[model samples]
Target: MKDLPADARPREKLLARGAAALSDTELLALLLRTGTAGRGVLQMAHELLAAPVDGGFGGISGLLHAGAEDLKRIKGMGGSSKRAQLVAVMELARRAIGQQLKEREVFSSPGAVKQYLQLHLAAKPHEVFAVLFLDAQNRLIAMEELFRGTLTQTSVYPREVVQRALQREAASVVLAHNHPSGTVQPSRADEALTQTLKAALALVDVRVLDHVIVAQGNALSMAEKGLI
Candidate 1:
């Protein structure tokens, strides 16, 4: 890094040409600050992004999905401080996306909705059932993880979901859950559960806008699939 020209440095290049001009490696290297052992910072960033084909979370998106504990297993990330910085950045990204949904119609940016759900649920090793409560105009009111573990129609109580929707005064909702098996395909049980909840919520004047199934780097919209 020292031998590189001033403008060639990540910090200087970012300031001069803007962040968009920097490669993914350069952007990551900026956060890393320095190389480790025999690896240069740029080289390390590249390796982390590339990872390995089998069981490795390859690329930038996958790296973030790897989370803090997974990152600890990687070389050059022995320092807790470095891991903290990455986790902090990921949290900021979540909040920033959440704020956008709060301020605008959640459906206006469907991709953001998927991304928000992914950041929150995609990394989980177990099943998680969550709901996004929405106002009259479809902006986010609040999101809650209402249930966990096996998400059967019986296990995920409709009574609890209806209560929360009422508590939030939500007019509509988006249901979501993560598949830790890395398969985003909604099961027959998933379809049955969505229908069960939709009917239960309908009694209270709440609409189930969508039910999304998420896994690492994948998502499925029940609404889009005509399963809702």
Candidate 2:
């Protein structure tokens, strides 16, 4: 009916077409059904996605650094929408952090880390560098992101990771990153980076559990293959 809104309107079509009837924009529009006087929620989401950043949502760890006032600047995003997006971003970061800490013993399974990272980082258009700081028991003390950048230029410093480990008093750590390309294969740089960090942490007596590569539906681990 003409009176039915866009979101409700889409549901009927979805059920009729088995979800294949929707366009990417339509799917995104469904996520944000409401719009403002000048801009619709879908339009705002599109604009946000279009912004140039590493891994797009991949690099959105910076969203944690975004003040409430900053999010309100979007045309159709008021307090609620802004908060929703912010909450989603923050939770993604929190989960990534959690996966890292889980690496002590039970956390030794890279599959677990991959499962967590894939949910948040794989769909991104850029890259995310994340670290998990764990206590001796590997109970998940904290998970932190070390860098966010384009697919090519992320400034991941091993010293910073070492410093954070010392600060958290973590006995060990796990490092992970996402590949927006949907490939779980580790690049030479990825291998080199993990090796570099492993050696650096050795001096301070902290352990490098594993370096995980997360793709859309898959993951690769350095430790499982004896690369670490």
TM agreement with the true structure for every prediction: 0.86, 0.57
Q: Per-residue alpha-carbon lDDT of model 1 for 1-228, expressed as tens digits? A: 777899999999999999998998999899888888778989877877874564345666667666688877768787898888887887788899999999999999999999999888887778999999999999999999999998899899999999999999999999999998989888999999999999999999999999999987888899999999
* Candidate that would win on lDDT: 1
Clashing residue pairs in candidate 1 (N, C-alpha, C atoms within 3 angstroms)? none
The stretch of ten residues in a row with the least summed lDDT in candidate 1 is 51-60
**TM-score: which candidate is best?**
1
lDDT of candidates 1 onward, in order? 0.89, 0.68
Candidate 2 ranges with C-alpha deviation above 4 Å = 1-105, 108-110, 150-154
How much does each candidate deviate from the true structure in C-alpha RMSD?
A: 2.6, 6.5
Instruction: Point out where model 1 deviates above 4 Å.
Output: 2-23, 50-58, 65-70
Clashes of 1: 0
Candidate 2 at residue 95, lDDT? Answer: 64
The superposed Cα distance between candidate 1 and the true structure at residue 60, in angstroms, equals 3.4
